[model samples]
Target: MSKEENAIIARKLSKRFPRKVFPRLEYFDVLRDVSFSIKKGERVALIGSNGSGKTTLLKTMATIYLPDSGDLLINGYDVYKHAEKIASHTTLISPALDFQKKLTLRQTLRFFHSIQAPYGELDIALDFLKRMHMEYLLDKRLESFSEGQKAITRIAIGMMKNPDIFFLDEITTGLDVNRKEDLVDFLKENISSEQTIVMVDHDPLIVERICDSYILLSRGVVVKQGRAKDIGKELAYKYEVMVIMKDRPEFDEIVMLFPDQADDVLIDGHVVYFRAEDEDELYSIIERLRLNRETITKYVVSLVDLSNIYHALKPETINEIRTVEDEKGLPERTPTFDELQEIIRLFGIMIDTKSGVKIPPRKLP
Candidate 1:
């Protein structure tokens, strides 16, 4: 690929921090010989446990933290030598960003515009504020804004730059569900095929929604890197499908028909449950069930999501995504879009949960 097509390139990158105490200076290695590349227009996620050097790597790429050794390039430009060229096309938004506490959001935007010359006019910045739903807070000082508002303002400022490359680190941490959804929608609508985005986020839902590929880091080492679906398969997210038929004989008939495809099949009265390795296999089974529409009454299916992948990859740190509990302490449930798609793809097997006609066995005249 051409140099412009290569958004980021890191070769044997390493970084170390020096600690001084009394008469001695000691060095601690944060990243060691890390190497990776991200193509332009690819939304790549940087994932790892805390202190795994995810943030350190991002900062180094953005030139906030210089690597002690090795070459780092943005659009084929040497990070140290062509830093200004890199900055012209890139914007970094991190929770660690410090702003002038005394300045209002409007003043901050003006100052940033003066320094970076992001937009020739203030109108663009105002438009971004409106998009972020923060136009009302434009006059509010940074000290008066809540943590979430501050994050929104920072994101607004970053968006105003119209960057070709976005380097984001924990930018969604303080956002509520509504604001998060809005941000996700905004990204989906605005992030075009010409832009490159690198994000560091702990929320798997956000990562799965925004990133097309992932670079998994463990203890400053590259552990895995690939497309999202391949990574999902490598993690082995299985699906369990259960079909309830109008009669027990239909369940037995299905078991007899696809004994090879269905294993560990169990029959509880008129219900049958089977497992599939992945969605492809599940789709095949659902096709067969559709052919046997006369027998099936209702069905339910469950599969793994991004959260499951996170659990399998970082069981030590990731927490389970739990549905809220009712007053009686029973968990409530709602299907995510991914889960709903799986359900609808396999929705053929499900006749209806209540009061639906079952097509009787075909009669050859």
Candidate 2:
């Protein structure tokens, strides 16, 4: 309700990049009227496919890039007008950040600490380095560190700041399973409700464990924003089970058992492929057929998750989910495969023929 109550607020935020194609300049939309607010102390995740503007949005919020047009407020202060003030309360940990490669781990911490107090505290940094099992490499130059080591180092530096709000952009890029687990443990122990965090991470397990909410972006727009658990349950809970039976095994009877849960049933050769909305539903089907376990030659269940949701969601449906209605409107819906082909033919971009794809007239010799 109040500025102090909100950690970040964006209104009609849009970003564009000019790309030159041949003789024409086309403005590529990176973020289009994307608007959302983060309550103070909320740990929210920003997720989407590659090139979905997650990084751009994070950079904009961190004051690294000014928006083409729109108002972006950080901790109740306008990002552009009060960048210096905001910097005091916010810290961003991203791979895009530049560092002196020649600087040793300890030196890097000292350099960043000079700019932001408490971030380079000797005691804190040393403690974190020890916990990361990296104290032994304190003298190692950044250029000599492995990618995972570099990630851990950057995270250590970020944790030292203990800012009011933290922005993370793909900080888990190079972490191994153990390192990732350690990072998650550290975040859980350190991040409290008194501090806010906006992280651009794709690992669903990590996200679900740390974040209370999420913002789903598509084609540079906020497609959905809600409780992380709820969204995950709604879109990521299903599982696909493929079973091979000694005989056909009554395909019609399996559907009867799961009247509502089982769907997309198909007998491809001898493999029966279908989907169950949840584990319980899948179990229900299994129980009904338990008496004939020997008849089931083989079976496989594939869990669906945020990745599945990303692939299944149409662009229009994504826009509708977030209900984005502002001056900067939704993108034009994508054309179907057939419709796209027709358009290409009309514009001579290329032509699909029986034998092969024909080159555009402009490229024809």
Report the C-alpha lDDT of model 2 over 1-365, residue by residue, as the tens digit.
Answer: 87779999998898887766768876667888888999998988887777778999988888888899888999889987998888887878997775788999888888777878744355666776787789999888889989888888877777777788899988888999987888888788767779999988767667767777878786687755666445434542366566787775464665564455334454555666555666787787666556557667878776644433433332223322222234666444433446545654554433234422222112101
TM-score of each: 0.69, 0.71
Please name the candidate that would achieve the greatest TM-score relative to the true structure.
Answer: 2
How do the residues 143-173 of candidate 1 rate in per-residue lDDT, one tens digit apiece? 9888888898788777777777899998898
Residue 160 shift from truth in candidate 2, angstroms: 1.9
Candidate 1 regions exceeding 4 Å error are 118-124, 238-276, 279-306, 317-365
Give the lDDT of residue 166 in candidate 1.
91
Instruction: Give candidate 2 misplaced runs (Cα > 4 Å).
Output: 21-26, 118-122, 232-282, 288-365
